[model samples]
Target: MSTTSTPDNLELATTAREMADQAPAGSLEKAVAGSVAITCATTRTYQEAIDVLGGIQPVEVRRPAIEFLERLAVAAR
Candidate 1:
C-alpha cells in the first residue's frame, strides 16, 4: 500500500512530533500528554472543517432534487 499524508494527517504527525520534543524526561506523563495532544489536534482539525461547511449549501443543493431522484431510479435498474 502507498503511504500519503493529507493535511489533517500531517497536522496529527506534526503535533505528535512537538509533543515528543516537550515531553518530560523519564516520566509517564510524557506518554499520556503526547497521546492527548495528538488526539486533540486531530479532533480539532475535523471539527473546524465540519463547522465551516455546516452552514454552506452544497453544490448539489443548487440543482433540483428531482434530477437526482431520476438518476438514482435509472441506476437502480
Candidate 2:
C-alpha cells in the first residue's frame, strides 16, 4: 500500500465511499464500490481494485465499474 494521498486521491476515495454507501447490499455495484473504497481509503494503488473489477460478469456493472476504476487509477498515481 502507498501513502500518496493527493487531493485527487481524497476526492476519489470520498466518491467511492459514497457509491458504496448508496448501492444496495449484496449487489455487484456495492461490491465494486466497496472494493474501490477499500483501495482508495487504504491509500493503496488501484491495480488491486482493477484486477478484482475485471472479473465482474455483467456488462452493465463492468462498464461503469471499469470507467470508475480508470479514474481511480489515474488518481492513485
Candidate 3:
C-alpha cells in the first residue's frame, strides 16, 4: 500500500494541533472538544493518504472521522 498526504489535510492537522494546545485544562468538555478536533484532523490525514494508495482497505477508512465526530458531538451534549 502507498500513502500520500494532501495540503488540506496538513492544514487541518495544523489547526487541530493549535486547538489542542489552546484547550482549557481539567474540564471534560474541553478535553472532548480537543480530542474530537484532533481525531478529525488525524483521520483526514490518514484517509487522504490511504485514498492515494488506490487499493482495498479496511472499513474503518470509510467512517473514522464521522464516527469520532459523532462521539464528540454526543459528549458535548
Candidate with best TM-score: 2
Provide the lDDT at 35 for model 1: 42
Error of 2 at 73 (Å): 7.3
How would the candidate models be sorted by lDDT, starting from the highest?
A: 2, 3, 1
| Candidate 3 global TM-score | 0.34
* Candidate 3 deviant stretches above 4 angstroms: 1-7, 44-77
Candidate 2 colliding pairs: none
Total backbone collisions, model 3: 0
Give candidate 1's error at residue 17 in angstroms: 1.6
Candidate 2 vs. true structure, TM-score: 0.53
lDDT of 3 by residue, 1-77 (tens): 11242234455445545655776776543454354455546555545433432232333333443443343334333
For candidate 3, what is the lDDT?
A: 0.44
Best-fitting candidate, scored by lDDT: 2
Task: Please give the clash total of every predicted structure, in order.
Answer: 0, 0, 0
How well is each residue in 1-77 modelled by candidate 1, as lDDT tens digits?
11121234345435444655686875544444344344435454434423333333433332322232223223323
Badly placed stretches (over 4 Å) of model 1 are: 1-7, 33-77
Candidate 2 error regions (>4 Å): 1-7, 44-66, 71-77
Taking all chains together, each candidate's TM-score versus the true structure is 0.29, 0.53, 0.34
* Worst ten in a row by lDDT for model 3: 53-62
